[model samples]
Target chain A: MEEVHGRHSSGWFDVCQHRRMSNTRSLPLLAPESDAAAGPCCPPLTERPFTAEEAETAARMFKALGDPVRLRLFSAVASHEGGEACVCDISDVGVSQPTVSHHLKKLKEAGLLTSERRGTWVYYRVEPSVLSAMGKLLTVAPAVL
Target chain B: MEEVHGRHSSGWFDVCQHRRMSNTRSLPLLAPESDAAAGPCCPPLTERPFTAEEAETAARMFKALGDPVRLRLFSAVASHEGGEACVCDISDVGVSQPTVSHHLKKLKEAGLLTSERRGTWVYYRVEPSVLSAMGKLLTVAPAVL
Candidate 1:
């Protein structure tokens, strides 16, 4: 059965999460336009609720990242060799075979990762737009004014 | 109790569940990256789990973004009028009041959001490094190459 979980792990999970968290926290303090290219447009969170469109968009991504197995798989793949990791590489990444595939599938649907087959291997790569958009969303911080 | 139940308003809940189901069948994918920066020092998830330094750093942020409430709150704040929202504005969003507070606190603790007292209103905005680093992390998709 599939259990609900969060996106980050500790130890190795720290790299991406660290990069992302520090990044997300920094922009609000530094400047405004840095993330404007990718982040959502609006004011502070405490100011109001997200609109339907915003909520849906963000929801889709979070839903994708919500799974612990998938999140770990993402970490494994990202940390894999050649910017891509084969399914063979992660068969033992602390989960069952089907679980790994299940996560890869969810991530693909989210458009955060894409795959291509090379012989017997299917490698995954991160979608820049998606990554940038995520970073952007995190950057939308308080307007000092 | 730490029950993060996503109880919907009956209709919305069903819709969410349905969407989740469809998403599962549609294409649960895994997003990976090939970073030009960071100089390729990490190992595979299967080969070795994430390091504590790595895990703690990453986990904090992922935990921040893991929840639906936090995601919505992040969006609402990011999309706010001036890029920051105050308590009054945030209180009006969906989810339970306590849930909202819980998420906001989490976000703040993760260093994504910061709060301040502006006369009568307590305002929240995105942190600086949090967004900046998030952007940088996206810019460079680290791969095993």
Candidate 2:
């Protein structure tokens, strides 16, 4: 993504929201406890089993990212120029245009990306909030004491 | 994973490391030329289209967590008491014994978990290093704007 003014140029407003770097230590609120039980709310994964509900939610997200094709397509869009890139650029990658388009659609459905049409071309970029949420789910409070 | 120090337990360490929850940031080391010469020496999904070698390495990892059975299994183990749980306990979670065993084996191969036998039963827990590394790949930087 293009770096202008020391930040991504796509839409700087997202800059004011959740962010991280190798700062794996920080995470937002916990995932809601499994809906199957009225048990106490979330405890870190280290603390106890993630409830069934939490597992299902997390599983869905991971499933979306589980594909090799989709993961790379996500990277290409998230790191492309101007903080976004059009379908024309993404199609230049080795994957077939149809495959690339399919992957992009998945990324969009998963809320990891958003797009806009610039004339005949469609541009895509990371949905920072969604990205941050995924990052948060991966957050397993730092190594235990 | 053995409990360490008495109070906090080594299981916590296992959960973080084995689960691959550690985060890493991809600080663009080499510019992507805006052309075809993408570098290979970067984090999992940056700089270039994933090579066969790279895709295999990455696919292997994603494939490890690709299954619903394994995802639930990993969470089950990561949150198990004493920081680990026996495969038998895992097998009892509504699925057949063989399916649980298979998922556990895949998780072990992917480095997301580790197993050890306690008498006749084998217990598995998250691998702290792997978890941490996985966590890093999803890390995002604070916008510099």
Q: Which candidate is the best by lDDT?
A: 2
Q: Specify the highest-DockQ model's number.
A: 2
How well is each residue in A22-103 modelled by candidate 2, as lDDT tens digits? 1233223233333222122234445455656666555555666677777767666665544466665556446788988988
Candidate 1 regions with alpha-carbon error over 4 angstroms? A1-50, A66-69, A79-82, A116-120, A139-145, B1-56, B66-68, B78-84, B116-121, B141-145
Deviation (Å) of A27 in candidate 2: 18
RMSD of each: 16.9, 13.0
Give one digit per residue, the lDDT tens place, for model 1 in A24-75: 1111222224322234443333335666556566656655654556656666
Worst 10 residues of 1 chain B by lDDT: B22-31
**Could you tell me the lDDT of residue A130 within candidate 1?**
57
Candidate 1 lDDT, B1-145, residue by residue in tens: 3333443223433333333222112211121233221122233232333554443454456556656567777766656545566654556566678878888987887767778675555667665445544444434333323
Recovered share of real interface contacts in candidate 1:
0.29
Assess the local accuracy of residue B74 in candidate 2 as a C-alpha lDDT between 0 and 100: 82
